[model samples]
Target: MNQKLNIAICSYRSATFGGGQGIFVFELSKALNHLGHHVDVISGPPYPKLENNIQLIKSPGLDLFSTFNFKERLKIFLGKKNKSSDDWYEFISALFGGFPELKTFGNRAKTLLDESSYDIVIDNQSLSYGMINIQKNLPLIEIIHHPITKDYQYDIQFSKGVIQKISKWRWFSFLKMQKKVSQNLKVISTPSHNSKNDIAKDFGVLEKNISVIPNGIDHASFTPILDIRRVPAQIITTASADVPLKGLDFTLYAVARLKEDFPQLKLVIIGASRPGGHTERLIKRLQIDQNILYRSNLTRHEIAVEYAKSNVAIVSSLYEGFGFPAGEAMSCAIPLIATDVASIPEITQSYAELIPAKNSNAIELAIRKIFASPETYQLRAEAGRTHIIQNFDWQKIAKLYEDLIYKTIDEFQC
Candidate 1:
């Protein structure tokens, strides 16, 4: 093994079961440490709670509007009292997009890079110009999980009306910054080939400069178990809270149609329902509100158990750069039916049954077809399992990252 290299990973949020960024940072650092590298995770609010061995450098955000428990801290700083979490969220939500703390994070990252000699600075989607302009001459490697442009496009198109659609177009501002910063980075890696192509097209970077490294899941933790919570005829999916791009409407419509044929059909959503949002309204209109189970704050093992218990797993995203839910479901050996969009087909090539992304009828038909035959479910699940184990084992993928780090270090030295 090569001598250990100190790796600095900067992410906007911690993977505290809230979203993918924290998960990516934590898992990547764990894998790097497992490979005998020193990994320092620097993050803003909603930080990852990693093991004791790994070093965590907190880059506290101004978070003017505290999202969760930061209201007290905000009060202490400003000499105020009795501010609620929602008030902080509303305040922060207004300014977080253009907040200067994010820029400060870049300065802090630069300081860490300068003082702590690292072989490489691995940025996990913190595409600020400060990171781009860091003084450290060390190789800077950026990991764009997927292009934000893809998310913006899907979200805009999913809007119910023209006004809402135009409103979403403003979120594309991140793309401009992402493009400018991405072009200067020497080695850029993404989660999937679909993402690689997206980066090439959207950011105007050459395909060769962008490498493909799929995200990994813990094989031991996500393994199949004897599931006791089996609802005889139920389907499960993980959706982003109030995000139209997730295709929750499509899944709800599909389940509504399937429920007529299979009345016992239930759509168990592994995400919290936003108050008075489209997801909640759709469930009400479909008259299947009673059949839906929406919950948040699930552990990895808990999610795996849900996968094991479900008759089938569905991913109804309008587009996925790389579908984490689909991969995790497959890791648990559940038959998958994901939207035939962006990278879903790439990961689930012949391993899954895919349907047109925005077609509710297609999703419904796929569900009916799978449940109609028990053997089909078994075959698809087995194939998905084989595919994931062969392609996405974290232990194997971690080595690629190790080799890439060494190669980047050598090139930087030369």
Candidate 2:
């Protein structure tokens, strides 16, 4: 048996239900600890909930996202007993419509790393200058799930107008820092080959230096519930509704079309929509408001139950690095329909019903076909479950990570 290593995982922010990155930090830390390693997660605001054994060292930031009102923020800035440079930078940048969380969080994380000792540092896509600074002090392995450049491209492509395009560009300006930091890292790990290719192209990193380690499904939490009754015509998808890249608008259009034939159809979104936001407006414009339901802040068990109850699950993203929703739905034995975008095909393989992205007609047709032949689709769904259990178990993924960590350490020493 290899000696257990002292590992530190750093993230700008982590929340159990926040998004993929947070879930990645939480799950990976737990998995590493389960493998007999001592894992410490260093994170900023929206701290991740970890298991008892795993230690969490809170590296607090301005937590500007938590302060919803401008008045509250103003009060903090005006009354200065004493404040860190990071606090002021975060408040100012965000007030001016720039994302400074990664930069500020990285500075704080670097300070923490300087005072702490770890055999290796695993950065969860902070992709900031501080990551580069930390590399000079300790061997660092970055987990770049996918390039933020793709996200910028998608946002720019889908912007509503010229003003929106400029805003999106300004907000994603951190991509410049990320690209520079990514290029200097000694080792980079990605969740899929598609991500590896995207990172190489978008960040200008050599493909040879990027390693592929697919994310795992928590089978224990995401498994099929035999006793739960499936809701007829219930469709489920997980995405941040306001983000255009998520392709929820296309899914909404498809559901509106499907209601003409299947009036009972219900689309359940496992995410929140801002009041008067684009998604909310689209829902009203399509007049499918009554048929759609948004459920946010769900526990893992609740998410699994949503998957088990649904007739079919959808991954409508224009692109995904790993497509966790698709994997989780498959783990719950639900038939999946996903767009053939980025890494969706890689994750779903032939198990899911593949459709062209940004095409509501294709999505509608896929849903109709699945409904027409329930028996056949159910078998395919079962095959997907088997696939996830065999290939995407977290234990298997952790072992892969363990080997990667050891290899990275050995190479750094030499």
Candidate 3:
């Protein structure tokens, strides 16, 4: 064990209930804290809910855009107090970038780093130039959840029209800045080998400069609920339906094709589609509305219950830097049917049934094949649970991170 040290973890979002990044920062910090280390999570709009004893440093964004309405908006504004120079810069970037809400994050980053003091500053994909300023004050380590370029390439390949392509291009314009930051920063960490290769190839960073730390799961929070019994033939997938990289729309397509043979086949999507949104329209067009279910705004507990009830869980992503859903489902002892996409195969390590992504026939066939062999589900489910526990559990991940952080700190001293 190492001496306890003051640490700061920063990210654009902190509401662990929302995305994987939030969940990562929240749980990882908590796990570190539990190990008798001092952890302070500095985050932006949609702030994280840390444990009562833990320190939560809120770096609020303007939140110019959100899925919520007036009352929720009021709460966000009313909750914020401090602002910083990075906030102003991020604001300018977002304004010019055409996504007004993004300005809030840019600004928050500037604000948080402008007056930084910590033993180590671990940035959770808040790859703003503001971080460069923090590096000037103390050792800074970045956790690139995955390379953003994969998402960009996936978008360019699957986009429907010129306008969509252009919009995605603008959204990803920040990656250039991120890549530059990575080159300058000495210490970096990513979740999986898939990400390690992508970072090296796309960002031009050396493999030695980056550390590999698997994403951790909270066995207590995500443990199975006794009542969530295995439904005879049910499947669950997570992510925004509009994103082609998620490849969930293809999963739904496979479901529609399989429904004729297995009328009771149910595909539960743990995310919603926008009206006139890519996913909603796809579902409407495919005419599988009756067999599919959509859920969003679920707490980790609720999601675990949903996972516990399903016969199998699927990761329909075309690319994953590190597959959180796949890992989480495996933690819950659910049989996984994941695609042979970026980094996913690395995480699953042949413990899962892998299929090629974007192929509806293959996805449908895999799902049906699993249905045909009920005995394999329990065996695979048990194997996945054991695998995740041994490898990706938070305690093990935290220890690895602790080693990397101290190593980076020592090197900086030299």
Best by TM-score: 2
Which residue pairs show collisions in model 3? 86-107, 86-110, 87-107, 90-106, 90-107
lDDT scores for all predictions?
0.77, 0.89, 0.78
**Pairs of colliding residues, candidate 1:** 14-22, 14-47, 14-48, 15-22, 15-23
Residue lDDT tens for model 3, 22-55? 7887788888898888888877767777877778
Give the Cα-based TM-score of candidate 1 against the true structure.
0.90
Candidate 1, number of clashes: 5
Decreasing TM-score order of the candidates: 2, 3, 1
RMSD of each: 3.9, 1.3, 3.0
Expressed as tens digits, the lDDT of each residue in 170-213 for candidate 1 is 44555677788788777888888889998899888888888898
Ordering by lDDT: 2, 3, 1
> Candidate 2, residues 1-414: lDDT per residue as tens digits?
289999999988997786787788888999999999999999987899888988889986767777768998777666655788888888888887789999988899999989787999999998989999898878889999889888898889988899998899889989999999899998999999999999999899998889999999887899888899989899999879688778988899999989998899999999888888889998999999889998999999999889888898988899898989989999888899999999889878899999999989888888999999978998999999999999998889999999989988888788
Evaluation by lDDT, superior candidate among 1 and 3:
3
TM-scores, each model vs. reference: 0.90, 0.97, 0.91
lDDT of 1 at 82: 56
User: Number of the top candidate by lDDT?
Assistant: 2
As for lDDT, the candidate ahead, 2 or 3, is: 2
**What is the alpha-carbon lDDT for the whole of candidate 3?**
0.78
